[model samples]
Target: MIMDNWISIKIAAQGPFDLKRTFESGHSSFPIPLKDKQDRWYLVMRPTSINTVIITRVAQQGSNLVAEISCPQRELKENEVQSMKKILRTTFGLQLNLAAFIEEFKKDPIAPAFELYRGIRLTRAHNLFQSLICSILTQRNSIWRWNAQARTMAKLLGEKYPVGHFLIYSFPEAKTIVNHSELLTKASLGYREEYVLETAKTLANKEKKLEKLKKVPTNEAQNALLELKGVGTKVADMFLLYGLGKMDAPPVDIWIQRAVSHLFFKKKEQTLAVCRDKLNEHYGKWAGLAQLYIYCWARDHLK
Candidate 1:
């Protein structure tokens, strides 16, 4: 049932909004690549059930970004609209005023590179469990490998819906994984299979845990996530930073270590702990944000 009327919500942003940069930051496969014919970005997501909603940034009128939101199952209900609004706002970082972060970056040594990618923010996972799984799958693996595994996981466990002639799949929920732990092996998860299953079961056991994590202090939340199987320091920090909306959490991988070393430590040798401390000291609350932008930039631009 296609409703003739689509609700138009205006989002005025504090900093410059660049949909292209945000999508290209190597987040995942949800946001479809640019299409000249559409002249906008399309995001397909499923927050509940197997049913999916397709959100598009339809237009930019002055300082506001107008969103055209629609779901295949039905017209969005009042509560659904609020949910979509919150998810979209968070996904696009509209609530994050980056003026101060950008100002601080301008004074840094890599200011030019950071400025070149100013509007790019961390495109977060759909949920906390999904973020944990992503971090686990990405550990010590190439981006290509993790993306392939993610796509396979999506197709196998996610609910499928028809969008025109095409079928769209959502990211698998923890319940789905908990119900079918063996299916993960087909994705060649290897040693991480057990960890993924355990994490899924843990998340599925309590619906309130993810919600509780949002309210917990950053250090406690990090430790709690660390308790889950396959979750290490980097994975926990990534979950805290991207999943629980804690910008103070900086997940420093080798790339970030190199970037930090070169940009801040005068290319001196430093431990990951020392590097993370430096990033926190310099970027403060925006440390995670700075880490993401610089990580992406360094991955592509730096040696």
Candidate 2:
């Protein structure tokens, strides 16, 4: 019943744990937070070396360990190791083909557009419920205010773990937040509190297939999300890109509309569908990554 030869060693990734956080974030599989002796946040790591799950943890001193969930059925052979290497490399941006692509773009540079926020990485690792809540909290609000709202919600509903000189907030489960509607006003979620509750209550029980979601048809996934109480195209795409790893998922926020509006179409009033088509044409398979990088860039610079 345990995993195969793949051991999920999450800590080995790096300090800016983008891929690890995405996998552990429940938007994919109910990413529950874990901790080590030093109270640092850890996630479940599934490595291919050994066929078992590891509740990977990082201590204050930065030591990493993989606590075996169960023993593997068999050791991963060399062929399997190579296969896993390929899968991991592709699935996660492990070895960013920075050399090849950076050379191509070197002539033009990353454009003045993407430079202001070169190093800002998204690090929020929460279950889809929390992701949905934060995304909903984000819509139509300033990113700063939305971040404030997120922090307020975390402080109000989530648990705080002290790690070295810093502290990280663990987002509460869907059931916890849904059961306490009054916390919204306290958390300053504003008008989206109802949306947050509705979405959470809807998925809190239904078994959602989120991990390895790239296999699912985009239309089906988008429709499924649309069926959720507060979820719409934007929310669905956010889940697809951030949680489910669909590189084709183009998440459209108002800021992005402005960024591409004049540049792509020579008009500032471009429609969402038009923008989607343009992005699909330009980014192709990795359109989701494009949207993410551009979204992060646009949000910071446009503001």
Q: Which predicted model would earn the best TM-score?
A: 1
Tens-place lDDT digits, model 1, residues 1-303: 332455766677777676666666765323333333445544446564223555344444554567777666666777777777777677667788776667766777657765678666565655555667877887787776776777678778976654333455667788889898778889897788888888888878664477688798888988888888788888788777777678888888898998888888888868888888888998888888888777886897767
Instruction: Specify the highest-lDDT model's number.
Output: 1
Model 1 poorest ten-residue lDDT run: 28-37
List the candidate 2 regions with Cα displacement exceeding 4 Å: 1-110, 113-116, 119-126, 165-167, 212-214, 296-303
Q: How does each model score on TM-score? A: 0.86, 0.64
- Cα lDDT of all candidates, in order? 0.70, 0.53
Model 1: pairs clashing at backbone N, Cα or C within 3 Å: none
RMSD of 2: 7.7
Scored by lDDT, model 2 comes in at 0.53
Q: Which stretches of candidate 1 lie over 4 Å from their true place?
A: 1-6, 27-65
User: How far in Å is the alpha carbon of 250 misplaced in model 2?
Assistant: 1.8
Q: lDDT of model 1 at residue 173?
A: 80
RMSD of each: 3.3, 7.7
